[model samples]
Target: MQSKLLAPYEIREMTFKNRVVMSPMCMYAVEKKDGIVTDFHFTHYGSRAVGQVGLIMLEATAVLPEGRISEQDLGIWSDDQIAGLKKLVAHLHKSGAKVGIQLAHAGRKAQVPGPIYSATKLAFSEKYQTPEALTIPQIETVVSAFQKAVKRAEAAGFDVIEIHAAHGYLVNQFLSPLVNRREDQYGGPIGNRYQFLNEIIEAVRSEWTKPLFVRISAEDYAQEGVHLEDYLMMSRWLRDQGVDLIDVSTGGVIPLEAYDVYPGYQVQYADRIRKKVGIATGAVGMITTGNQAEEILRNERADLVFIGRELLRDPYWVKTSAKLLNAEDQLEVPTPYQRGWR
Candidate 1:
């Protein structure tokens, strides 16, 4: 049977060749403090493109220097980084894959030397740094940083731009009541907590006309944390803000908690948000096989399947999946690999 996983998906003007997406997984390969793309990034992403992954979402690239999760993470904060990013995008395009970059800020989670910043002056753990709470003006500056990063992404020729609002990052910090303890308009109610993300989206829209995505940690896993219902409201707000899709992920608001985890564990969150909010969503986490990916799409659980660790283990996962599902012809095998496929 033909694989639904191999079907084409279109968001905005860009058409993904298949439903399989390489979820952004950071490779701490940058060799300089400048956070430019190195040969490792080119080779890493290039191999996935060559293996026929439909959309390659590059890892969490910081929008500001201090926002980096680590010193080795990629950055889009400078004009000098554009050329290297453009080169990577160009190669991925040549190999028949759409490309995206996850624009992010680690917030209090940043392990770098400088002052860490968060919505509240809270540290993720005893070992983590106590972040300086952003003043109102400082918050605006962060929003501006996102705007500038969008401009850089446009200049770098990315097909899609995903805002990293999930995984206990900067935006997630503001969204969760467990951390955002501000009395200002930026805190208190859920609507107020959403203010930071709302402003960033608006600012990004000003400079970006292409397809935009936001990765949100839908379920914070704590009793006081944001839940699936909260994410439904968040997804609705995102759709209204001109977001093309929501990459659904869960947890990471606080220190890790014990939860039942298995294959396609997060697919339920994607299904719920997509149905309730009436917006496209992507399912990620523990989704390893082509059949599992196909099942999600066939049932209309999500618009796309984001494969992470599986792809890290095997860059040619898409191709191998095509063969497993007897849909080998759906993916274009390189001339050199034609013999193996035959």
Candidate 2:
């Protein structure tokens, strides 16, 4: 049965069936009204639940209306949306998977007319318009939105709550000097720049009792964005503040080759963040094989691994991966479905 050590583990009060996680991917099927998730969300997340991944982080859900990446993005700013998200958590739990929600704000990335949003703006191009910078009150509102959303997630029965501080989103924007040129308290050197994230984490930490996770861009890939060294400094602070894990994923801070990135091109960030922070880390990006995943775990580079596009390609990738890892017997089959794998 492969190493049982890799089978199930616990942090805070939630236990996952394995180290593999379903990295959040947008279905772009969401239908929201004044910032709320609709029936489509339940069906979409519910199906992912049945796929048997150890942990599932919902996509980048906006915390406010103006913060939304697009018209169809899921949101968590109201009670109606909370009800639907709760239903998702219940369904996923019954399906035998722990659930997580990724709370995000698109910052200058907001209000894109399509299903996807990007950080900063393309004002220099004839095709795009630069966004209005958020005011102090607006920043405070976003902070509350995240706190409220996280509380809603707990009420909705989510086992984990991952703060989306990566991908050049709101928090990412603040962390990056390139995008955030504000002269106020939220900009400047590392300490001042991290104020936004620190406040959000502190607020969420005060209100949330679950295993708090943070997804971060180890390097913004540009000299102006948050560099790897800054992450080392910031990650230590995150650990001190009671963050359980750092979801180490890169890019989205600056545009780079998305399709051409080689396997584990970004894994180095994961390794460094883990060592620098001394916290449990989740390595994600270009990871595609059982041995590769196993090697990461064996070398202690990361405590967990998240598989994105790969899982979308094979819902039962876990079963196949177990076979490749020679741990087939650990498969937790439902009695009715045992015969298939047998």
Candidate 3:
């Protein structure tokens, strides 16, 4: 039987060979703290391309130095960083895998040295530093940073550009009502809260003509936090702005709550967004097996399945998954590994 998960999926001019995506996960391997790609990054990402992942998305890359999640996180804030990224993209392309990067700003969640910026002065927790509320001029600076980052991403030859608006990051801080207590233009009503992201998208779209994606924390898991209706509204705006897909993940907009965690736990959010918003979605979180991923595609739950830790555990996960679904013939095993792949 043929595998739906192995079918090619297209968005704009980019076509993915399969439904499997390497979900962006922070490696924290930049030893120089200069935000440049190191040898570890080449080996780490190249192995996955060799394993045949259709779309390999890089981890949260800072748009500003202070926006980093840590000193070791990747950065795309400078023109100097482009060559290394370009080389990485070229490496992946040689293996027939498309490349993507998540443009991010850690905001109040930043664990770096300097002060972080957010919609309000609220800190994520007692453990985190209290962030300075972004002034209007400062907000504009942040938007410009995203625009500059998009230009850098384009120069690096990325097939996809995903704005990291989820996980309680700078953009998420502006999106969630519970955290953004500002009564200014960037806060209060939903439209106002959306203004920050709206500006960033506009800036990014001006430079990025390829497939654009926005990762969102679908639910806040807090009673008064962002809910489905809020996300739907935001998603509709994203659609209007020409966003290609919504990478749906739940929680992480606030402190952890006792929510059930299991395989496919987040697929429901992705499915709902795809059906309700009439936009494509990528399902992620604990999705570990071939059957699980195949079901998501065959059932039309999501257009893509983003695998994280599982890919880290097995770089050849595509081959393994193909074997599991008895669809090994669908994947072109690398010439060097063909004998062992079977």
Candidates' TM-scores? 0.99, 0.92, 0.99
Q: For model 3, how does the per-residue alpha-carbon lDDT over 46-127 read when each residue is reduced to its tens digit?
A: 9999999999999999999999999999999999899999999999999999999999999999998878889899999999
Candidate 2 Cα lDDT to native: 0.78
- Number of clashing pairs, model 3? 0
In candidate 3 the C-alpha lDDT for residue 329 amounts to 88
Per-residue alpha-carbon lDDT of model 2 for 147-237, expressed as tens digits? 8987888788888889998876778877877777777887677888889899899889988888889999887777656778888999999
Clashing pairs in 2: none
Could you tell me which residue pairs clash in candidate 3?
Answer: none
For candidate 1, write residues 1-342 as lDDT tens digits.
Answer: 678899899888789999999999989899987889999998999999989999999999999999999999999999999999999999999998999999999999998988989999999999999999999999999999999999999999999999999999999999999999999999999999999999999999999998999999999888999999988988999999999999999998799748889999999999999999999999999999888999999999999999999999999999888888889878888888788867
Residue 98, candidate 2: Cα error in Å is 0.5
